[model samples]
Target: MTSDILLLEKNMHINVFGLNHNTAPIEIREKLYCSESDVPVILKKLKDWGLYESVVISTCNRTEIYFCSDDSNNSEESIKKIDAFLMEHFGVALDWLKNYTYRFCDEEAYRHLFLVASGLDSMVIGEPQILGQVKDAYRMATFHNTTGFFLDKAFHKTFNVAKRIRTETRIGYNPLSISSMAIELSKKIFGELNRKKILVIGAGEMCEIALKYFKKEGLTGIFITNRTFQHAQKLAEDITGIPCPLQDIPDLLTKVDMVLSSTGSEKPIIDKELVVSIMKKRKNRPLFFIDIAMPRDIDPEVNHIENVYLYDIDDLKGLSQQHLSDRLKESEKAHTIIEEEVVKFSHWLEQLEKNPLITHIIDVVEETRSNELKRMMQKMKYVDEETLRNMDLLTRSIVNKLIHRHISLIRQNGSPSLLEIMKQLFKFEEENEKEMDSGNEGK
Candidate 1:
């Protein structure tokens, strides 16, 4: 195979091997999840291990790794290596991952990632959170120098395509999110959120979005708290609410009817004992806790307490599925947009595949034409400039027409055999030059 064709083939082997809501339950996903700070460390480790071009997208619903590892085109071996890396990082065994993981290769992997970034593959269809998470993963990969040219360009293109999909289609028509779905489920238990007091913990993106949904539903009292008191104070100012210092959470918990926690803390912030004490202070009234953080801010065991309803990220997936079923029409529209982008990018890849052969052909033809023109002028130096110009234009037209079909063919398929054949047939080297000189001598 020609070097150009070989290089293209090598780079085309993209693989996505990881677990998502479809293949794994929340328990498994949570185990596989990485905190945002942990993203760069894992990506750099992959780079050091030679899985250089890769991105890891970890959210409450899914934790997937997309990488290019085409060292020998052994897809099985490449996937195994990736799984082993995940096993080491997440402490999940490779055999266990086989049951809870889904794998996509080449174009399938590309389409899957596009769907994910477009929010079609999210637990909450059309949620805008996934796009930001996807960008964060790409950014982390870039910062760690783990991504190569193909991955970097592909990620930027993916972002553009995702934006187009969101805009051109009715997918985000209602603009629903996981946070909104959490509110929807809460309404089932608490009746109406407008009358209920809410406490928003952490001023991160997830927390910000959830707070917006709650505010839209209307609030009796809004309170914001963060590890950084200034961030909470800023968010509270914008929303016209109270900002409490982190130290005041135990006191604040008793005043709020609903608590939404989405912090980056590695451990549970509200244990069962803490929440139990807070419930008694509320006169045993119903208090709902929604823990949206991956590591979970509210203790799962808190659900055991009387009049304390605690739901973590996993509990809301069922609610999100309801949103997905309701948004089928939007999903179809988004799929159509993604399909168009796939074809466009696939064509671009085809052109990239043809670059080397195209360059070689152009170089030979232009060089041969230049040498022929110099010979014509060397012996006939007295010739007029216009005549020389006419000769040059005539040669250029012939080369353009002759090469046009090959370019068209490459755009369609760009097979390696065709590239090799073109290289052989388009040889304008020494023997052909000698033949041309002989023909001139005869003339």
Candidate 2:
């Protein structure tokens, strides 16, 4: 490859290093959980460490860092650096990083991103929330000026691919999100949801969405609480539910038959001790808990309490399979769309790599054609507008036809030998100057 092509290929070195729902359990994923504020810091850190482009996406189910550098050969070292950074920043163990994390480079990395943005790789197949999360991540990266040309194109293409899947396939038809699935599981635990009451902790997007599902089921006495009381009030107002302060969780827990929690809290908010006391106040009324938050808002030990059932994100996985079965056909279609986009994206990168030489080739050929045409026109007495137009069209067509094969060759396989030949053929500066001088003398 020529130096330009080599440089282009180097800049295409995109990679992702992190853990997701499939590769890591909730415990491992939460350890690397990057909140919104953490992304800019991580992006700046990566950039400081010499990455050209980077984006960090950390949701309840996955924590992934997508980055690129103009050193394809050093991808291994770069990924190792990212691994060590995650270990140190998240305080995760080496064993967990080795066993629970996954890394992908170039094509595989972009493919995984497409799967994620399209929700094909979600815990619940065809979930739509992940797309919004991916968009938010991309937006943050761009705001921090961490994404460059390659990542910008890749992410834009990813959005297009996701949109195509959404329009072409019915993957999102009656979609099942983590919240929806949690509601489904709750129905199994407590039949006739309309008769039972539920308390939703944390008024974030997930909690808000879950409340809507709960309301649709005609659930009575919906209570919402959050660390920021205003957010809880806003969500409750939107859903016609009751709003309470975070400190009131203990009181609310005793009255509601179920508790659905999804928050950004870094630790378990409702522990065994708290639940133990709440259960007594409720007379042990079989209160079910859905802890969908990343760090797990409810303690896992709470499951052992009598008449109390607990389900975290991992527990929701079993329920997802049932939803997946219904959307398998659509999921397959979405995967097909992703494969097509990946191939197109690869071709685009190849074209980008070969563009410098291609542009030179076109410039030389077009200038040569223009000089020759000028020389012919100078030889003639005068050319009418119709004749001039015809000649111009004929000359342009001939030039394009002659150069088309060479351009295709560069795009398909930009080998060093071929690049050198095109370079030599198109380096007509001295000859073009002489030809133009001769044409001017004739004039």
Candidate 3:
């Protein structure tokens, strides 16, 4: 049992695969992006193909999948399947996959996840949005029943570590998000957003957050629009903006000085033709577009038009450099905190890995004792209640005494050969008997 537990600990490993902003360009990342609705299908496929647990975290900056297999021997095969699946499903080129995607196993994997959860790995280092994104991804995995013991522990610990970073360091102080960065770019494009009329497309969280920043900058006209008009109205009511219908986008584009768009749409919301026509209506007024969506809400070609400026999610990376430097010291502290938590988590997981085998050993021994006692009682004639209780207690005491050393050895140290001997003594499964016998024959 001791050796088996040790083997399990050695065999079980957490793995992570996929690309982030650092590894891949926005174009490559977007190709590999998995929407919230698309995650369950991927998770199910991964499980069907031998992954024990899985979670997919798909944000504008990254699309990473974390998973584990039941055995280490199967990990390579599982990773190959994942690579093939991601490439085929997303239509990613083989060269792109090799050039862009990253793979990490065990300590490296969880460390990457920890950095991601704590926002240290974000394009805007120390941004708080990635933590929430990680939580949402984990929650989605849980809802789909893809997460079990390993992932549950890893993610819960990640949350705690993120919270610790937030508490201990000033990393999250002033919290720079993609929305805040977009607002900053807008300020740079058109100085002083006060009294500026900005049309915000999509009333999602990103839009709401950017609107708050805009409101703080004293923006007077904030028009919110979405495919669902009610959602637009709700967000506009919350943010003190005017609610506009999706159909009114072209007309609104003619009026606003700037447009900030973030929607979950698969295709570009505003094309070059529409923007070109709107530019004519505005009489070549400098209209800036900040697209904070994954696939991008505004067309990239819109930047070609005279007096039109377009910035997608990747464009914000350059703007965040100064912000990243500002939080460098705090980020260092956060990294230190994450490393400490990673070590602690590794220790806890090791101890946890031993528990199942230990429990199974005790259960098997106890069952044997219980069955023998039942047989002995059936042969006896009319034993008193007190005697029967004493007999049960006697058997339990012997069983405990017999297995105490085995449990202690398991808790302390275990060897492979000893584990095999114990497995035979305790009548463990015979699946490996032939292999063991063949090895013995060579001796």
Preferred candidate (TM-score higher): 1 or 3: 3
lDDT of 2 by residue, 1-443 (tens): 13323344334678888788999888777778998777888899898887878999989999988988665447788777887887788798778898988889889999999999998988877888899899888877866768755786688788889999989998876435677777777877887798889888888887777778788989879998888899988988999989888888888888889888999989889899998998889887899999889988888999999989998888787666655676887888888888998999898677766465564566567668778988998998778755765675577668868887988887878787887787777773445445444533553
Q: In candidate 3, where is summed lDDT lowest over 10 consecutive residues?
A: 1-10
The lDDT, on a scale of 0 to 1, for candidate 3 is 0.79
Per-model C-alpha lDDT, please? 0.76, 0.80, 0.79
The clash count for each model shown is 0, 0, 0
lDDT (10s digit) by residue, model 3, range 361-403? 6657766776798899899989975677567556655776778
Local accuracy of candidate 1 as per-residue lDDT tens digits, 1-443: 13323333344566787788988888888898889888888787777766758898888888888887664545687677777877887798777799998888767788888999988898767878899899878766755557654575567678888898778876765434577667876787788888889989899988888888889988899999999999998999888889998888899888888999999999888898888888888899888898989999988989898888887888787655555675777788778877888788777665654355554565566567667867877988577745765565566558757766776676676687875577678752455445434533553
Could you give the candidate ranking by lDDT, starting with the highest? Answer: 2, 3, 1
TM-score of 2: 0.53
Which portions of model 3 show Cα errors greater than 4 Å? 1-10, 175-211, 214-323, 354-443
The C-alpha stretches of model 2 lying farther than 4 A from their native spots are 1-11, 177-323, 357-443
Please rank every candidate by TM-score, starting with the best.
Answer: 3, 2, 1
List CA RMSD, all candidates: 16.0, 15.9, 15.6
Model 2 lDDT-worst window of ten: 1-10
TM-scores of the candidates are 0.51, 0.53, 0.53
Winner by lDDT between candidate 2 and candidate 1: 2
